[model samples]
Target: MNHQSVDVNTAQSFVPKVSVVIPIYNGEADLPDLLSCLLSQTYPKEQVEYLLVDNNSSDRTLSILQTTAENSPITIRPLSENNIQSSYAARNTGIKAATGEIIAFTDADCRPQPQWLNTLIQPFINPEVVIVAGEILALPGTSLLEKFADKQETLSQKHTLAHKFCPYGQTANLAIRQHIFTKSGLFRPYLTTGGDADICWRILKANLGKLEFADDAIVQHRHRVTIKELSSQWRRYGRSNRYLHELHGIELTREIKTKEYIYILLRWLLKEVPKISIQNIIGQASFADLFNTPLGLFTSRERSLGQKKAQLPENAKVIEWF
Candidate 1:
C-alpha cells in the first residue's frame, strides 16, 4: 500500500532530528544488508545520526562498524556495552549517546524501507505522540521455517498492539521521543527479551504520551531458517512471558493439555500428511513445516510452565491491569 503522507502544514513545523539506534551482537553476517538499508534511507542525512552499539561481539562486527564510520556519508557512531550481554543493555548504551530529538530503533537483521524513518517520524509531528511503531514483515526466504514466519506474520506490530491490557511495539520498528526515556526510565538492562513491552507499558501507565502506529513505516525482518533457530526463538518468547508475569502480575496461559497434544498429532497425521507431495518428499518444499507449528507451540507452553517464578526486579511495582 502507498504511504499516506502527513500534511506538514497541519502540524507546527514538522521536521525533527532523528537518531537511528541498532544493537548488534555477532551480527557481522547481517551488517552489510542493514548498513545498505540505512545508507539508502530517504530521511534527511543532515537531520539524522546512526548509533550502532556492539554488545561485545566475538566476531568482526565492531571492525565493520569502524570501517563504515570512516567511509559512510552518513554519521555512524560505534559504541560498546560489554558489561551486560543483553540486547536491551546495548540499546541503552546507544540511547545514552543519541543526540537527536527522536530515537528510532531497528535490529541488525532488519532492513527498513527507504522511507521508513521519514514515515515513522511523521506521526510525531503531533506533540502528543511519544511512541510510533512501524510494520514488520518477514523477508522472503526459501526455508520452511522462514516461510512459516511469513505466513503467520510473526513479527507484525498488530499482535502486540492488540495486547489485552496495554499495547506495545517491538523495538525492530519503533521510534520514541528522547525525553520519554527521562520520564518513564530506560528499558530494564538485564532483560534479554520483552524489554520493549515493559518500557512501552511503563510509559503508557505513567501517562507520559500517546503511542501511534505507522503502517507505512515498514521494516523487513529476517526469520529463523532452521527448526532449531525457530525453536529457540519461541523458547525465548516463553521465558519472556514468565518475566512479564512476574513484573506485572499478568495471567499466564496454562500448560498444553494431553488431549490438545493428541489432537495436534491427529491433525498432523490426517491433514498435513495429505499435503505432502513429490516436492515435499524430495525435501524441496515447505509443506511439511506446517506440522512443526503445533510442536513449537507445545514446547513453548511447556517451557513457560516449567520456568521457575522469578522475583520482581529492584524497585519494580506490580500493576494489575485486567
Candidate 2:
C-alpha cells in the first residue's frame, strides 16, 4: 500500500517509477532468493517498486514476503489473488494494482540481472515502443533434464525471433508500459501456461503496441531438473499453446507419426553419439546430457501429443502439472 508516485515537478530527482511485478504460488522456498536478488538490483530504490501477487499459496510465502518488505530498502508491495489459481490471474491482479508507469514482470523462481529493470524500461523512453521483451536464459545446470530444457529454450527463443514472431517474450523477463494493459487487455486467466505468448501476440496483432527486444535485460530461470517434472511442465505448455493457436486461427500443417518420431530418434543417435568427448560428451556437456537423447526425444513427442489432445473439447482443461 506504500506506493510513491514520482512526478518530475514533485520530486527533484524525478526518476520514472518502474514497478516490478511477480506472481508466486507455493514459492516459499524460492521467494527469499528471488527477493534478495530484487533488492540487490541496481535500479534506483525510490523509483522502483516490487509488487508480488500470491496465488493462494499453501505455505509461508506470504509471511516471508511481508517480513522481507518490512526491512527491505526498496518499496515492496505484496498482494493476494484468491479468486483464481493461475499465474496469469495473479499477474492481472498485480497489473491492476500497480502504481508505476512501467510494469516489469518476472517469476518467483527467476533471478533477474542487476540491470534488468534499467535495461527493460529503456525502450519505453521512446513513446512508440510499449512492450519490451527481455532475455530468459537458463540458470547453470549440471543435470540432463536441466541442460536439455535450457538448450530447448535457447533454440525456441531464437526460432521465435527468426520466424518474425511479434511481441514475443516470456513473463520471466518482460516489461511494458502500464497503459498497454488497458489497451491490449490482461492475460487470459484460464490459461495456466502460454499466457505470456498469448498476450504478446494479442497486443502485437491488434497494433496496440510496438514490441522491442532487450537482450541486455536478462533473467536466469531454473528449468525443471527431473524428467517427470520436465514432462509435466512441457505437456502443460503444449496444451495451453494448442489452445492459443486455435484461438488465433493458427493451424498445424501436419500430424507427427510414430514412424517419424522413431526416425528422429534414430537420426539423433546416429548423428549425436559420435560428438561426445571424454566419455562421449561435447564441450561443457555432462555425461547425463550425452545419454539423454532418447528421453529428450520422448519429451518432445509427449508435448506434441498433448497439443493434439488439447485441441479436443474433452481434453482442454488446464490440469495442474507440478
Candidate 3:
C-alpha cells in the first residue's frame, strides 16, 4: 500500500496523458530495467499513472514492486487470491483498476523506448482508432537459439504490420480504450496463452473500433537465452493455443495446414535433430518453429471446425470469451 507521487514541476510538460499497466509474474530480474524505462519516458509523470499488478508471483517480484512503488508514482496492487493463474487475468485486474482513459499494456520483461508511451498514444488523436499495437524488438543475447527466436518474432511482427487483415496484437506492446474493457468485459481468464490474440479477436468481432500499428512505439522483449528455456516456452505457447481455441469460438486461420505439419516433422528428422545430435547437444530443445506454419494451420482449422460444431441453439446463454 505504499503510495508516493512524483513532483512534476521539474519534468517535461508535453507528457501525453495515458496509463501504463504492467502485469508482473516472477519478474524480479526484469523489474529494475523496466521501471527505469518507464521513469525515463518523454511523457510527464503527472499525466501518466503506472499500474503494477502482481500475479501471485512466488519470487521477489512483490518486494521489487513494493520498493518501486515507494519511490515512483506507480500504484501496486497485490491480488487477494492468485485464483486466476494466467497473466491475462492479472492484466484484467489492472484494467478494472485503471483510472486513465487510454490504457497501455506491456510485459514486465519489456524495456520500452523513451518515446514509447508518447508514440503509442499518438494514434488516439484520431477518434476512429480504438487500439494501437506497438513494435516489440527482442533484446540481444549471445545464444543462437535466442537469435532464431528473435528473428521469428521480428518476422511475425513485420507480417502483422504489412497485412491489413491481420488483427493480432501482443500483450508486450498494446494499448486500448479503457471503456472497451469496461463495457465489453476484460480478457478471458481461461486462456493461459495467446490471450492477446483472443482479446483482439473479440474486439474485432464486436466491431469495437479500428486497430492501428505504431512502429514508433517500441518495446524490447527480453527473450530466454537457452534452448531448454525456449522449448518449454513454446510448449506452453502450444498448450495455451489449445486452451484459447477451446474457450473462444474463433479459429486460427487458413495459413496453417496439414501438409505443413508433416513438413515440420520431416525437417526436424532430417535437419535440426541431426545438427544438434552431431554437436553432442543433449537438451529438451525444439525445432517447432520450423513446423509452426502447418501446426498453426491445423490448429486454426481444428478450432474453426470445433467452433462450428459447438454452435449453441437459440435462447441458450451465449458464452462470453472475455
lDDT to native, each model: 0.82, 0.75, 0.67
Q: Runs in model 3 with CA error above 4 Å?
A: 1-16, 73-81, 154-156, 159-166, 247-322
> How do the residues 1-322 of candidate 3 rate in per-residue lDDT, one tens digit apiece?
0112224442234344577888888888887898888878876667788888888889988877777677766444443227667677778777777778898999888889999887787776656677888888888865655656565674234554453444666888989988787556677664556667766767776888878888767988867666456545655555444455555644433344567667776776688657766544445444443444443344345444543344332322222323
Q: TM-score per candidate, in order?
A: 0.87, 0.85, 0.72
**Model 2 lDDT tens row, 1-322:** 1112334444433357988889999999898789888977887888888998999999988888899889988899999998888898898888888899998999999998888886677666557777787777888888777777776674234444443344377788878888877777778776777777777787789888677777777888888887777778767766866876766655542456889878877876777666654444435555665656687666777678778777534332332221
- Candidate 2, poorest ten consecutive residues by summed lDDT: 313-322
Minimal lDDT window, size 10, model 3: 312-321
Kindly report which residue pairs in candidate 2 clash with one another.
Answer: 276-280, 276-281, 277-280, 277-281
**By lDDT, who's the top model here?**
1
Assess candidate 3 and give its TM-score to the true structure. Answer: 0.72
Candidate 1 at 291: error in angstroms?
A: 2.8
lDDT by residue (89-160, candidate 1, tens digit) is: 888899888999999999999999999998898988778889999999988788766666777777899999
Which has the better lDDT: candidate 1, or candidate 2? 1
In what order do the candidates fall by TM-score, top score first? 1, 2, 3
lDDT of 2: 0.75
